[model samples]
Target: MKKIWQLGFLLTMAFVLLVGCNQSETQKLSTGKSEKTTQTTDKTATYPMTVKDALGNEVEFKEEPKKIVSLIPSNTEILFALGLDDKIVGVSDNDDYPKAATKKEKVGDMEFNVEKVLSLKPDVVFAHESSAKMVESGLQQLKDAGITVFVVKNAASFEETYDTIKQLGQITNQPQKADQIVAGMKVKVKEVQDKVANVKQRTAFVETSGEPEIYTAGKGTFMQEIFDLANIKNVVDDQSGWFKIDPEQIVKRNPDTIIVMEDEKYFPNIVEKVKQRQGFDSITAVKNNAVVKVDQNLTARTGPRLAEGLEEVAKAVYPEAFK
Candidate 1:
């Protein structure tokens, strides 16, 4: 069943790319005279700027996009970290990190309200790659209305995430700030890496959501990379991306620790559920009660705060390292 779903998702990915292609064709207006590639130079970004976005689409900005709308929390966090708070005209309903973001006009939930986004009259809108599949028509409508929208790709690793952050900084005229943020992240991650180097690696079972669906992060996902940094081995590392796991399989693997990435409120009770599940009772993590809680946003969102997430994972997986 998981294989079938994975295959379907791969096929769907092709269609999603095509959606971006179609939008690119419609929205790829001339960015004005092409200038030399000075992305490496330390200077204020010049406009009529043109850059290729995560979706492999060439997006042009006549000038620095001031009235910006971010349709995702990750992008919103990056923008705020770059000190573009005054320029952020609107944000998604899920944008809650900066607290100031909460004061911004709410466009909509994950599936953004096209009407609300347009009413905000943003010069540029930051979108997620999933929007290609989830709100293709709304995205098309936004493109047709002459609005510039850049759909950020789903970063599978931390390196890719850093590149996206740099890309955002370039387009938003904050390249220097982006570099500083990435540097800080690297320093923090290095601190955790150095501390966990001597610890014995533990096999971990990481749960992304509550049961019934029973999803866990697999190979090629950000979670797996974070686990690796923490000197923890994922039980489901053999699979790719998020995949469903059967209780029997989990018991067979018998992970040494279970890390729950949901709200803390779900703990103890969810821990009980894991213990009650047939075949899961005999699992080492269940018998030893080694379940730990991690914030969902830290592990999930691939933004500036990802370094903090990596540190949290290291602590959760190996509490002794922190002490």
Candidate 2:
């Protein structure tokens, strides 16, 4: 599958660079010193992220990994958020956020250039389950060569995501900092939930992509899950993953609320375009001001800022609940 290759390219490119960090041990500063963290605002974030990689070897970095590499886009975002941006030496070719991320080097897409990753010499590499097999195949040799690696469970739910974030804090030796970040996120999540918990059920459609007319993200995806969290009913809850779709089906569905994750550069215009489609004129979302635009990066990727993304989804799906 194209996505599998894409997944491979993104993950490997992300993994190689971070794990390439020099094995030369760095002295651990006594208990209160902060590791490399992002300087934006005073928001401190840290986390533990050690666990066996798919290769069956234990990996750990004692003093906050000074040179880090993030294979997953979501993990890349989390690293940045945890005030660990400076430590990140390389990122997946797809990791884009905080605008500044674009300035960093990209190893390659899914089937990232392993050679390039080896050169960066990262202190640690962050990876997850989706690419575990590929990561294992590629890194087993690298492990024999002696590189510390860790595998993070790519969590499905928001709660699991929180736990993962906390885990990241602990592994990175910034438990207190990481806890503070999660605490702040919890406040925002609860705020969003409280705002929409009592709203009426809104039928929403989350657009995935289109070519042979593909559309997906139903009952199991993080997108649909977010809707359920907001108490909104997904019109395509029966579908699984992202699938091929047509406007005719959408028009017939006539969902009450519509959520579009992709547009021309995250613009709100797609909502209007979907509304203009044939038959959709009769749909409630098009008739009312129920059409909402969501940024793909914010909603689609499972990461630390996911709570913020959920808040956006919740607000779009249920405005009255928030107000």
Candidate 1, 199-232: lDDT as tens digits: 9888998886566667677766667778888889
lDDT of each: 0.76, 0.64
lDDT of 1 at 244: 72
Per-residue lDDT over 1-323 for candidate 2, one digit per residue giving the tens place of the 0 to 100 score: 54444433333433342222212111122223453433222233233323343344445455567787777787777777778867788887777786667778787665566666678887777776667676666555444556556776656566656666656665565556666777888898788877877666678887744333445566556666677767788888876645557888888888888777654543346667777777878988888978787776676566767778888888787776666
List the candidates' TM-scores in order.
0.86, 0.78
lDDT of 2 at 179: 68
Candidate 1 matches the true fold with a TM-score of 0.86
Off by over 4 Å in 1: 1-32, 38-42, 263-268
**In candidate 1, where is summed lDDT lowest over 10 consecutive residues?**
20-29
RMSD of 1: 5.5
